[model samples]
Target: MIGMFATSKAGHDKDTVYIIVQEDTEYVYLADGKYKDTEHPKKKNKKHIQIIKKESDDILKEKLIKKQPIYNEEIRKAIGGIVCQKQM
Candidate 1:
Protein backbone atom coordinates (compact mmCIF):
# COMPACT_ATOMS: atom_id res chain seq x y z
CA MET A 1 0.00 0.00 0.00
CA ILE A 2 2.60 2.56 -1.04
CA GLY A 3 0.24 5.44 -1.45
CA MET A 4 0.41 9.08 -0.44
CA PHE A 5 2.82 9.95 2.37
CA ALA A 6 5.09 6.98 1.89
CA THR A 7 8.78 7.69 2.52
CA SER A 8 11.74 6.68 0.46
CA LYS A 9 14.07 4.26 2.23
CA ALA A 10 16.48 3.56 -0.61
CA GLY A 11 17.84 4.78 -3.91
CA HIS A 12 18.21 8.40 -5.04
CA ASP A 13 15.25 9.50 -2.94
CA LYS A 14 16.38 8.10 0.36
CA ASP A 15 14.85 9.83 3.37
CA THR A 16 12.28 11.78 1.37
CA VAL A 17 8.56 11.34 1.82
CA TYR A 18 6.57 11.07 -1.39
CA ILE A 19 2.99 10.91 -2.53
CA ILE A 20 2.36 7.93 -4.75
CA VAL A 21 0.32 8.96 -7.78
CA GLN A 22 0.30 5.64 -9.60
CA GLU A 23 1.51 2.06 -9.13
CA ASP A 24 1.97 -1.29 -10.74
CA THR A 25 3.45 -4.71 -9.95
CA GLU A 26 7.02 -3.40 -9.84
CA TYR A 27 7.05 0.37 -9.54
CA VAL A 28 5.14 3.46 -8.39
CA TYR A 29 4.95 6.97 -9.78
CA LEU A 30 5.77 9.34 -6.92
CA ALA A 31 5.04 12.96 -6.71
CA ASP A 32 7.80 14.77 -4.97
CA GLY A 33 6.09 17.26 -7.25
CA LYS A 34 4.93 19.37 -4.35
CA TYR A 35 8.56 20.15 -3.62
CA LYS A 36 8.67 22.52 -6.58
CA ASP A 37 4.95 23.07 -7.34
CA THR A 38 5.32 21.22 -10.59
CA GLU A 39 4.02 17.73 -11.45
CA HIS A 40 7.38 16.00 -11.55
CA PRO A 41 6.61 12.54 -10.39
CA LYS A 42 9.50 10.12 -10.10
CA LYS A 43 8.84 6.50 -10.78
CA LYS A 44 10.73 4.17 -8.45
CA ASN A 45 10.83 0.57 -7.46
CA LYS A 46 8.07 -0.41 -5.05
CA LYS A 47 10.52 -2.05 -2.67
CA HIS A 48 12.32 1.24 -2.18
CA ILE A 49 9.37 2.82 -0.44
CA GLN A 50 8.71 2.37 3.24
CA ILE A 51 5.14 2.29 4.44
CA ILE A 52 5.08 4.06 7.78
CA LYS A 53 1.31 3.82 7.98
CA LYS A 54 -1.94 4.24 6.10
CA GLU A 55 -3.20 6.81 8.57
CA SER A 56 -3.16 9.67 6.12
CA ASP A 57 -4.86 8.19 3.09
CA ASP A 58 -8.53 8.44 4.06
CA ILE A 59 -8.17 12.01 5.18
CA LEU A 60 -6.13 12.96 2.13
CA LYS A 61 -8.49 11.19 -0.22
CA GLU A 62 -11.40 13.16 1.25
CA LYS A 63 -9.53 16.38 0.62
CA LEU A 64 -8.66 15.28 -2.89
CA ILE A 65 -12.29 14.48 -3.60
CA LYS A 66 -13.18 17.95 -2.36
CA LYS A 67 -10.54 19.32 -4.76
CA GLN A 68 -8.29 20.66 -2.06
CA PRO A 69 -4.57 20.80 -2.57
CA ILE A 70 -2.29 18.49 -0.61
CA TYR A 71 0.88 20.36 0.06
CA ASN A 72 4.33 18.86 0.63
CA GLU A 73 4.33 20.19 4.15
CA GLU A 74 1.30 18.08 5.06
CA ILE A 75 3.01 14.97 3.80
CA ARG A 76 6.12 15.82 5.79
CA LYS A 77 4.09 16.34 8.93
CA ALA A 78 2.26 13.06 8.48
CA ILE A 79 5.48 11.14 8.09
CA GLY A 80 7.09 12.92 10.98
CA GLY A 81 4.10 12.18 13.21
CA ILE A 82 4.02 8.54 12.25
CA VAL A 83 7.73 8.10 12.83
CA CYS A 84 7.40 9.71 16.23
CA GLN A 85 4.52 7.42 17.12
CA LYS A 86 6.51 4.33 16.20
CA GLN A 87 9.40 5.47 18.38
CA MET A 88 7.12 5.59 21.38
Candidate 2:
Protein backbone atom coordinates (compact mmCIF):
# COMPACT_ATOMS: atom_id res chain seq x y z
CA MET A 1 0.00 0.00 0.00
CA ILE A 2 1.09 3.55 -0.70
CA GLY A 3 2.94 5.32 2.11
CA MET A 4 3.31 2.14 4.15
CA PHE A 5 6.56 1.44 5.97
CA ALA A 6 8.39 -1.86 5.47
CA THR A 7 11.65 -3.62 6.21
CA SER A 8 13.59 -5.73 3.75
CA LYS A 9 13.12 -9.41 4.57
CA ALA A 10 15.60 -10.67 1.96
CA GLY A 11 18.56 -9.40 -0.02
CA HIS A 12 21.62 -7.35 0.90
CA ASP A 13 19.32 -4.75 2.44
CA LYS A 14 17.77 -7.22 4.82
CA ASP A 15 16.31 -5.46 7.85
CA THR A 16 16.61 -2.04 6.18
CA VAL A 17 13.51 0.09 6.56
CA TYR A 18 11.79 1.85 3.67
CA ILE A 19 8.65 3.60 2.60
CA ILE A 20 6.48 2.04 -0.04
CA VAL A 21 6.09 4.53 -2.84
CA GLN A 22 4.52 2.32 -5.46
CA GLU A 23 3.47 -1.29 -5.92
CA ASP A 24 2.27 -3.77 -8.48
CA THR A 25 1.28 -7.40 -8.34
CA GLU A 26 4.89 -8.58 -8.21
CA TYR A 27 7.01 -5.74 -6.89
CA VAL A 28 6.97 -2.68 -4.68
CA TYR A 29 9.01 0.48 -5.08
CA LEU A 30 10.67 1.59 -1.87
CA ALA A 31 12.56 4.64 -0.62
CA ASP A 32 14.58 5.46 2.46
CA GLY A 33 15.02 9.10 1.55
CA LYS A 34 18.74 8.56 1.86
CA TYR A 35 20.09 5.97 -0.56
CA LYS A 36 16.69 5.45 -2.13
CA ASP A 37 14.97 8.75 -2.52
CA THR A 38 11.50 9.28 -3.92
CA GLU A 39 12.91 10.18 -7.33
CA HIS A 40 14.89 6.95 -7.49
CA PRO A 41 13.09 4.33 -5.42
CA LYS A 42 14.33 0.75 -5.20
CA LYS A 43 12.07 -1.86 -6.67
CA LYS A 44 11.89 -5.13 -4.77
CA ASN A 45 9.73 -8.18 -4.59
CA LYS A 46 6.57 -7.52 -2.60
CA LYS A 47 6.99 -10.75 -0.71
CA HIS A 48 10.53 -9.87 0.29
CA ILE A 49 9.50 -7.00 2.57
CA GLN A 50 7.80 -7.03 5.95
CA ILE A 51 5.16 -4.34 6.28
CA ILE A 52 5.60 -2.07 9.28
CA LYS A 53 2.62 0.20 9.05
CA LYS A 54 -0.38 -0.18 6.86
CA GLU A 55 -2.21 2.71 8.47
CA SER A 56 0.60 5.22 8.34
CA ASP A 57 1.03 8.88 9.21
CA ASP A 58 -1.88 10.93 7.94
CA ILE A 59 0.16 13.59 6.18
CA LEU A 60 2.51 11.31 4.29
CA LYS A 61 -0.23 8.83 3.49
CA GLU A 62 -2.50 11.53 2.10
CA LYS A 63 0.27 13.09 0.05
CA LEU A 64 1.35 9.78 -1.45
CA ILE A 65 -2.22 8.76 -2.20
CA LYS A 66 -2.95 12.10 -3.83
CA LYS A 67 0.28 11.99 -5.80
CA GLN A 68 1.40 15.29 -4.32
CA PRO A 69 5.00 16.43 -4.20
CA ILE A 70 6.96 15.05 -1.26
CA TYR A 71 10.53 15.73 -0.24
CA ASN A 72 13.27 13.44 1.03
CA GLU A 73 13.55 15.24 4.33
CA GLU A 74 9.90 14.61 5.02
CA ILE A 75 10.28 10.94 4.28
CA ARG A 76 13.37 10.62 6.42
CA LYS A 77 11.66 12.39 9.30
CA ALA A 78 8.59 10.20 9.08
CA ILE A 79 10.64 7.03 8.98
CA GLY A 80 12.84 8.20 11.82
CA GLY A 81 9.81 8.54 14.02
CA ILE A 82 8.74 4.99 13.30
CA VAL A 83 12.17 3.50 13.83
CA CYS A 84 12.53 5.38 17.09
CA GLN A 85 9.25 4.04 18.31
CA LYS A 86 10.27 0.50 17.44
CA GLN A 87 13.54 0.84 19.32
CA MET A 88 11.72 2.10 22.37
Judging by lDDT against the true structure, name the best candidate.
Answer: 2
Model 1 per-residue lDDT tens digits across residues 22-74: 56799877765445321556877888887655546577656644646677665
| TM-score to native of every candidate shown | 0.57, 0.94
| Reference-based TM-score, model 2 | 0.94
Per-residue lDDT for 8-58 in model 2, tens only? 999999999999988888999999999999999999998899998544688
Tell me how far the alpha carbon of residue 35 in candidate 2 is from the true structure, in angstroms, after superposition: 0.4
What are the runs in model 2 whose C-alpha is more than 4 Å off? none
Could you tell me which 10 consecutive residues in candidate 2 have the lowest summed lDDT? 52-61
